[model samples]
Target: MDAPQEARDADVSAIAALDEPTRRRLYDHVVRQSDPVSRDEAATALGLARQTAAFHLDRLADESLLDVVYERRSGRAGPGAGRPAKLYRRSAKQVAVSLPDRRYELAGRLLAQAVEESAATGEPVRTVLHRKAEELGTQLGEQDDNTGVLDLLERYGFEPRREGDAITLANCPFHALARAHTETVCGMNLHLLRGMLHGLGEETLTARLAPTPDRCCVRLDPGA
Candidate 1:
């Protein structure tokens, strides 16, 4: 089943309300859990007392960022068991926030520029985009597995869309930066992707800047 849209929106609002430290702790806890975490486990992982963990967990639950999936043994289950321990997991709906919103707006402008430039030059935008996408995909493929590459990309705000033998970056994480300084930002993205790919054991990838009237940027490719 899917979450109701209102509930999803509420979660986003709640996350936006949290302070950075609390938000970081919450995000880290959610990402690290392979399964629902018991209150005790969360406390231990965060080096907090059980009561303290419970407070934050409950707050997160109220915001719908977490869902109580089930009850579990507190390791003190007995013939006369007291309250059952609650296990918490991240909700299917995730909170979304664009920190420093100006940046995102800027990124949109930059992308528009790139698109416009391509159009003016009489080049097929899709063709140029696909070439760039392929370069990015090859760079990501250098990783041992798709998950590792995806994780790296996520940190940079580029979510990957995997197709049969290729991957497309669904979003540009640095939209604001890219738009404001196309050459610099695009080059940086290329360099960052190159380093990340190389660290994952790929040694035959290259990135080159391709200028379009709308946007000037680099494209990545597998070395011949």
Candidate 2:
């Protein structure tokens, strides 16, 4: 189970940018500051040559690990401010690569939405959860133009594997949550996948609860 290929590749590239010792040092120094760090300031702090610091800092900026902003440290307006010293700060972007790929944020979003709606409408929490999950799945399927069933499954980290005519998910993206709240989460997953199948107009496969010790609670079976 992994993230989307483009995201995974970009993350790998960004992480690889930190492999160089000098570049890593420059990045660490820049991010630790409350404000952006100037090239000269970083060089002086790290005991590196000014040119060497600039080179590595630029590299980090290219990887999007750092953001570059031009500012005049001299506190001058339109006068001889000296071309606005290039400054480096940690980028607002966050990158995390998890083995077996988890998306707790996605689960949290669904659960939060369920709670809010339930509180607002006085509906049962479980009913709202299942409804929200199904809605999300429908949206995902509607937005998908080219992707098929298996492709969509893999993209979301279900780790789908075909066993004979049916496909069983090898990993659940919400594995931990499902473990803690079996009935609720599993029912939500079943409705979500059923919505997916319906939205995708998949007539040959059926989504059903088929829990096992090693795989996801929901499975895609061929026909009934």
Candidate 3:
């Protein structure tokens, strides 16, 4: 699935924040340490002023690229410890973006689900894959009760375009894998979309394999 615009923008901002040399250095130093780094420790390690280190660290924390916590450096606590030092560590959040909106993460999830289900039920991998894909597609359709297939597909970066009565998918969310494993990927895509149509209560349209140059392997057309 396409990453939401807001999430994509935030990821871009986080990556852009690291373009500053000092910020990048500070980030690298913090992540490499076994423990979270205090601003003073980062400053001394990177030859940056303590104030500068604090500023960059706070920026990183704000962007959610780094996690922040407070701890007393002195072995003592309560009355004796001078103060809790602010520290920075790498955050668990992941950021990724592709220009054409590749969704290998989505593909991987489907494949993993297929494998697990097949192992458990002794079903063929292909059968499990198709079933899993359809389930996922139904889930996608359920996300917006008010939207139709075209709007839903567009929101997910399918790049749908009107072609007479049919809608041509201009971008495949699984472009690379589809190219490498055409039959399997295309079949999975076809079933997934059919499931989506079913879940959306769409009776007038149908999804079918209609591979063309510079576009997805599936098309949605009006049913008789």
Candidate 4:
């Protein structure tokens, strides 16, 4: 079944609010499992007591990061007397450490403006964008690694999607910035991503703007 976008967005927001350690623990619990896990299993895996696990598990559920499913289990009564335990499954949602959605919306608007300005100049949009991206990538590299780049994108409310060797900026990081200074802000993002790639030694990266209805952004080509 297809997942609802709103629900998935909520999960991403919820996870983004957590501290590093908490987020790590939560992600580890979900990603390593092949099936929905029981409260007992989670506690065991994390070396926490059942009640402790239950508490965090409930929080995750409340955040829509987890869903409760059921499986058959033996009852205390004699043979064939069994019921299903309330098992927990990681929600069909991607978790991210980022800002809220409203901010990202603003960033997109800003990018649209930048795209407009570049278009007006009769410059190939991609060329101008790539040049700006290279500048930003150089600066970002001075401060952090690839992982840091991912974190920065998340904090700015970008939903980062990673596949094999490629990373896509799924959401706009400069939503508020976009609304205030559209062109300039979008230009900055192009630079930022480029700087981030360069910092990560991904200088040979190739990025393509995603098609419409998705918003404006670039991606890293693993092969490059």
User: Scored by CA lDDT, what does every candidate get?
Assistant: 0.59, 0.87, 0.88, 0.62
Clashing pairs in 3: none
Tens-place lDDT digits, model 2, residues 1-224: 33367887788888889989899999888888999999899999999999999999998998899999998888888866578888999998788777686767778898899999999999999999989989988877766667788888887788999999899999888888889999988898888888777777788999999999979999999995
| Model 4: residue 210 alpha-carbon error in angstroms | 23
**Alpha carbon deviation, residue 79, candidate 2 (Å):** 3.9
TM-score for each predicted model, relative to the true structure: 0.36, 0.92, 0.93, 0.38
The residue pairs that clash in candidate 2, if any, are: none
TM-score of candidate 4 to 2 decimals: 0.38
lDDT of 3 by residue, 104-146 (tens): 8888889899999999999999899999899888888877778
lDDT of 3: 0.88
Residue 27 error for model 2, in Å?
2.0
TM-score-best of 1 and 4: 4
> Which candidate, 1 or 2, would have the higher TM-score against the true structure?
2
Error of 4 at 32 (Å): 0.7
Ranking by lDDT: 3, 2, 4, 1
* Model 4 residue 177 lDDT score: 56
